[model samples]
Target: MVGAGIGGLCAAAGLQRAGVEVVVLERADEVRSGGSGLSVFSNGIRALDALGVGDAFRAVTTRTEGLRAGQRRPSGAWLSTLPADAVAELRVIDRADLHGLLSDAVTAGTVRTGRRVTSMYPNGLVESVGSGTAGARRAWDRFDLVIGADGLRSAVRTGWPEDPGVAYSGYATWRGITAAPVELRGEAGETWGVECRFGIAPLADGRVYWFGVRTAGIDEPGDPALLRELFGSWHRPIPELIDATDPAAMQYLPIEELSGDLPTFARGRAVLLGDAAHAMTPDLGQGGGMAMEDAATLVGLIAPFAGTECGDAPELLDEALRRYDELRRPRPQRVAARSRMIGRLAHAPGPLLCAARDLVVRATPAAALGRQAAWVHEWLLTR
Candidate 1:
């Protein structure tokens, strides 16, 4: 694995459990997640269970169910919500905590930090860079298979001649976790306004994870106070969430996703996974879930090779990878496209369009929204 992000670490855990010797090369000085929070939908929970980290994942977030979540206006009026049964599959977790859980699931010493992959091929030949002055030179390793989970700017994906690269979503977000436990007051979900949205949810540990988003340029001011300025007057706890967050820890991120289409995710003895393969806007909250699903699907396809030597089943591996591409690629692309559309709707350009959107969202039946939620959250991994 060429990256130690969630997708890569999850794959490492499963492969090691299947008796495969895996090495996860991470470019950072250490393995950690940068984001403040993540929404792990039902499919994601199932993926973690398949990857053998489900127990820890659930343990991190004790409140697995019963979150009455839906959209709200600036006045805090409920817009529309899936029925409790539909939303039962949703759980919010601190990204860093989940990262630690997945990291622990992997075998000790499996991830070599500060190692950057310079080049890779379909035949599993890899050239990596080290951190120190003496370690600057390229070092080579050949493996039975290579996986690129290196996020949006993946080196493995970059080497692909067909790669379309990434483009900004014309929006930015500020995410933060409360320094101390804050009372959720039984409130959760997103509050929407013109070009701005505030999402709030409680972590299992009582700390609240919140995110504020607005349609804007990447270089157009991203200060934490921008979140306050944009969302201060929206709602009650929304302001409290922002006030409780330390300014230094808040994250300002510009949303970006893959621009064009890639012919295939499986290329030679190497494959792309997670954001490396399909970097999507976070509008649908499926970015992490899709990555987890990818990990589980890829691992399940190769599970038959457990306890066998690497490269022992080249033709079979090729066939399985083909299937991986066929099975994994379409759903996420569809989801990504859907997310983009939702982002546009959520961040509609003008007040008139925004009003129309709010009216449509309000008039839509909760059950109708529930059905749509099922289409995204009810995914099953076929072995």
Candidate 2:
């Protein structure tokens, strides 16, 4: 395996349970020490359960009560209400905390950091740079299979240049966690305005997690004060939350998604997973969640070899990779399209369009709201 991000680590845990000896190579010198929070829905929690880290995740995370959220105009008027059931399935956890938990679950010595993959060969031979050196000193190692859990700009995926590259969603996002706990407004939800949106939720540690979205160039200026100016007057507690955040800790990025039309997620003995496969907008907060699903599903698909050593026959692994691609590709692409659509509606460009979106969202029944998401949240691993 290459790249020890969420999908890689969780996939390692699942693979170990299946009695597979795996080595994970990461480009970084150490596990990530910093990141914003992530919202894991029930499906993601189940994926954690399959990997045996659900309990650990619960210990460090908080359940968001009533997935109740709605769009709000600049004047702070409620524009629409999203009634959500399955409140127990939703949680907000700091990214670093979750990363630590997943990393700890993996067996010691399985992960080697500071090693960057230089290239992958057709016969599962992977070349990497020596520790502490980018690509100066090279070494070669062969494996039965290579799984790429690298992020959107993936080395493995880039091998297929004909595939459409990462598509920018014409928006940028700013995320930060409060240095200290601050009093919050609603249980947890978003407030939308013309061409912009603000979201707030609480973490288990009493600190609040929030994110702001707007339609802008990827290079738009991102200073804390500017964030304050952009959302300062939108609503209460929004300003206070911004003020409470540590300036240095905030994260800003241009939103981008992978082209839904990837020729294939599997190439020879190598396969792609997570953002490397289907990078999507954060609109549904399922990028990480879906990656967890990929980990579980990939392990489950290879269950026939759980107790047997099948490494001698590379064809068996090739067949498994094809199965993984067949079962995993379409759902996430559908989700990517849906998430992009929601981003468009939430960040409507004009008052008239925003008002129309508000009316449509307001008219939808709450039960219908739950049903709409049921398809995404109700997924279960059938072993």
Candidate 3:
């Protein structure tokens, strides 16, 4: 495995648990120490359970009670109310916390840091930075299987260019966690307004995780004051959250979604997972959760073929990749389209469109909402 991000770590966990000798190569000196937070939906937890880390995750996370969806009016009146079940089986946690958990579970000597994978071949061979003495040449190592769990800008993906690079979603997101004096009453909530959206949830600690997004054509400016100025007046607790944020800790990035064409996941003995396979917008907080699912699925697919005919490995891997694409593609595409549509509706030009959209949200039954997400949340890898 190359890239020690969440996807790589999870894949390593699954493969190692199945008695596979796995070596994870990471370019960074260490795991990412700082990231905002991630929502671990029930499906993601189930995937962790399959890997035997679900209980540990639960111990360090907080289960969301419910979600409060509303729309803010130009005059500051909340014109919408869509109360969702708090016990929707979704939990939220800091990225660093989850990374620590996975890192701890990994067997010693399986993960090598600061080793950059410079290139890869069709065969099961990869070249990475080797130890050198006084400018002497170094040596590279070979593995049976190379899993590319690298993130969106994956070097493996670049090595074997697949679909045209990542597609920009015309919007950017700013994420930060802040101390909250009041406890969050529900799981999480989102407030949508014209071309702007704000979401907040309480973490296991007393801090609240919040993300503010707006449709912008350019790269994020990465200024805390700008985030404050844009979303300061959205609603109660928003400005408070912003004020409580450490200016230096705020992170910003433009949202980008990968095109769903071609089979770039596996070329011969190498395979790609997580964001390397499909990186969608965060309109739905399933990005990390989906990656977790991909890890588990990939492990299951490969475990059945261990020690099989060497000639069959490529065919088996291809079948697994196809199944992965079949199972993961539709749901994430739906989520991406839903997120984009919601953004459009939230940023509608006239009051009439906004009113209509709010009406649909209000009229939609909570049970129906749950059913809409059932296909995603109720997924079980056991089947």
Candidate 4:
């Protein structure tokens, strides 16, 4: 396994639980101790269950009834609201807390920190810069399989000729958490504007997690003051939440996703997973969830290869990987496409287009919206 982010760690947990010997290669010195937060839907919850960490995750996360989104005028009147039932059984977890959970679930000593993999070969040989060795690179022991759980710019994916490339989504996002002040209490939801959006949700503790997104250049810099100037007058808790955040804790990121023409997620003995395979827009909040699903699905498909007495282990492994690619590829790509379409519609640039977008949302019944979203949140792990 390469890269110890959410997807890689979860994959390690599932693979280890199946009695497979595993080692995770991460470039960071240690597991991330702090970061923003994430919202996981029922589908992600089910993936956690498949990985045997569902209870551990619930212990540190706050469960919400559903997802609610609406558009507001700059003056703060509701243009339209997606019904609360649109997304059922939602939960929010601080990224650090969830990372700690997955890290603990992995067998101790399996993760090698501060090691950067320079390249991986088709025969499962990984070359990495050894930690504290003054940048000396060496080949690690070969393995039966290699998983490219690395994020968007994955080394393993780059080594293969099949990779198409990555594309900029033309948007940027700022996320942070603040201690919930006395005035904030209630359900969680998102407020959308012409080309911008703000989301708010409560953590298990009293802190509230929020994110602000807008259409912008990929190289644009982010400023908290600019966020205030843009959204300060829009709504009551929105500005207040921004004001309450610790300035240093704010994180800014430019959104990007895999090209729609990504070739194959698998090549030879190595395979890609998570953002390495299908990076998607955050418009639907399923980026992390899809990665979790990928982890669970990958491990579930390959379990038979662990400690098998069959003579043709290599052929069996190849078949399992073929099945993994066949089963896992289409759904996430479809979801990515849907998320991109939603982002384009929500960030429509012209006044006439924005008004039409809001009008269509208002005219559409809540039940109809819920039905359209049901396919996303209703996913469950087969294992």
Candidate 5:
């Protein structure tokens, strides 16, 4: 396994629980400690259950059950309010908490921090650079499989044959967690404007996780004041949420996703998973959900190979991997495409288009919107 993000760690944990030896290679000196927030939808929750970490996740995350969630205008009037019953399974989570849970699930010493995977091959060979040692690279081999769970610019995916590259989504975000909890006024969801957005959701603790997004150049300045300038006057808690954040800890990122779908997620003995395979816009809040589903599905499919006594172990491994690619590819790519389309519509530029978009949003019934979203959130773990 390369990269130790949610997907990679989840795969490692599941693989270990199946009695398979696992190793996780991460470039960072330590498992990344903290992050602002992540949205885990219903499908993601079910994937967690399939992975056996459902309870651990629930203990640390706050369910969005009773919160009035949906789209809103900059003035704070609801364009559409999602039905409470429709969104009952959604959860707002602090990334660090979820990371800690997956990290703990893996067997101790399984993750080799600071061991960066430089390259991998179909023959299950991994070339890595370890900390110190004059940056000496070592080649490790003899594995039946290699999983690339690295993020958007995955080395494994980049090294895959006919790699299609990634594209900028033309929007950027400033994400932060408040130093202290700010009063939410009993609401959680996104506030959308022309070419921009602001989101607010509570963590299990009182601190709130919020983000401000703007359609901007990929290299837009990471100015802490930009958020206030963009959202200070919009709504009551949006400004207050900004004020409660620590300037030094704010995170700025330009959203990007895979440029195009790969012909296959498999190359030789290696497979691509998570953002490494099909990075999509977070407009649907399904990015993390897709990753979790990928991890669970792959782990489940390959479990029988863990201690196979059959002489055709290699054949079984090959079949399972082939099945993984066949079963997993279409859904996520479709989700990514749908998310990209939503991002474009939400960020429609100028007055006329924005007005039309808002009108459509207001006209759409809440239950109808929920029904449209049901397909994305209705997945269960499959073996």
Candidate 6:
């Protein structure tokens, strides 16, 4: 595994559990100790269950009751409320907590931090900066199968020369977590307006995770004061949440999506997974969830070859990668497109369009949304 982020660590957990000898190399000096919270939907939980860490994850995370959507009225009120009962039960967790859980699940010494992978060959050979080596020294290591669980800026993907670059979405996002006062309590909710949206999900310990998104117009740097000036007038408690957050804790990410139509996930013994393959918009909160699903699927597909003779392993690995891509591609693409579309709709500027959107939200049956999400959450692991 290259890149010991969430995807890499989860991949390590899954492959190690399947009796595969795995070593994870991470470029960072340590697991990122701070990050925005995540919404782990039931589908993702199911994937964690398959990896045997669902319960452990649940122990540290808060299972969300559902989502509530509304519009901020000009009169400082909220209008057009809709609940998330239509979707599967979801949980909100801090990213640090999730990373810690995944890291703990893997055996000691399986992961090496600060060892950056500089390049990879087609035949599963990886070159990386050795420990204490100065000025980009090259060292080689080979594996029967190489899983690139590296993130969006993946060196492994670049090394293949087969992958395309990331395409920027027309939006950027600001995410942060604040300690929700003991008095305020609720499930997750989102407030929509012309060309802007804000979502808030409460963690188990009363810290509320919130995200603010708007259409990225150009290369302007993020201005938190401007964000507060723009969104401070939304519905109740949102202002409070924003005020509670420390300015330094906020993270700004320019949205980007995968545009290449890569036919195969592998070149020789190398395979890519997670953000290395599909880094989609977080509009649907499925980015991390999809990565977890990929990790689980890769393990199930490759387990049979763990102890098989060396000659047969390469063929089996190739077949597994083929199947993995086939199963994963459609769902993530559907999600990526849907998320982008929804974000566009939410950010529509015209009063008529906003009104029409509210009308649809008010009229659309929650059950319909539930059914759509069920298709995503109800994935059964195949042996």
User: Number of backbone collisions per candidate, in order?
Assistant: 1, 0, 3, 0, 2, 1
Each model's lDDT: 0.88, 0.82, 0.73, 0.82, 0.87, 0.77
Runs off by more than 4 Å, candidate 3: 66-87, 130-139, 305-326, 347-356
Model 4 stretches with alpha carbons more than 4 Å out: 66-71, 131-134, 181-185
Scored against the true structure, residue 367 in model 1 reaches a CA lDDT of 79
After TM-score superposition, what is the CA distance of residue 103 in candidate 4 from its true location, in Å? Answer: 0.4
Instruction: Decide which is better by lDDT, 5 or 6.
Output: 5
User: Which window of 10 residues has the lowest lDDT sum in candidate 4?
Assistant: 179-188
> What's the C-alpha lDDT at position 355 in model 4?
84
Put down candidate 1 lDDT per residue, 230-266, tens digits, no spaces. 8888878888889999898899889999997678998
Task: Please give each candidate's TM-score.
Answer: 0.96, 0.94, 0.87, 0.94, 0.97, 0.91
lDDT tens per residue, model 5, 1-383 = 99999899988988888878898888888887564888888899998888889889988876767889889988989999988876788888888888988999998899888787887777998888876533565757557789999889999999876788989999998888999878887798899987999988888778898889899999778698888788888978898988888898888999999999989988778988899999998888888898899988998988867878689988888888898899889999999999999899889998799999999999998878888789888997666
> How well does candidate 3 score on lDDT at residue 348?
63
> For residue 134, what is the lDDT in candidate 4?
36
Model 2 over residues 60-168: C-alpha lDDT tens digits? Answer: 9877775456566666677656665645568888888888998888999999888888788657899888666444577899987889888898777776654568888
Residue 19 of model 4: what lDDT?
86
Instruction: Give the per-residue lDDT of model 4 (tens digit) for 284-365.
Output: 8899898999999888887867877678988988888888888788888989999999888888886788888888877887
- Write model 6 residue lDDT over 102-154, tens digit each, in one string: 99999999987778898888788888895543345567899877888888878
lDDT of 3 at 17: 83
Off by over 4 Å in 5: 131-134
Q: After superposition, how far is residue 54 of candidate 2 from its true place, in Å?
A: 1.2
Rate residue 230 of model 3 by lDDT. 78
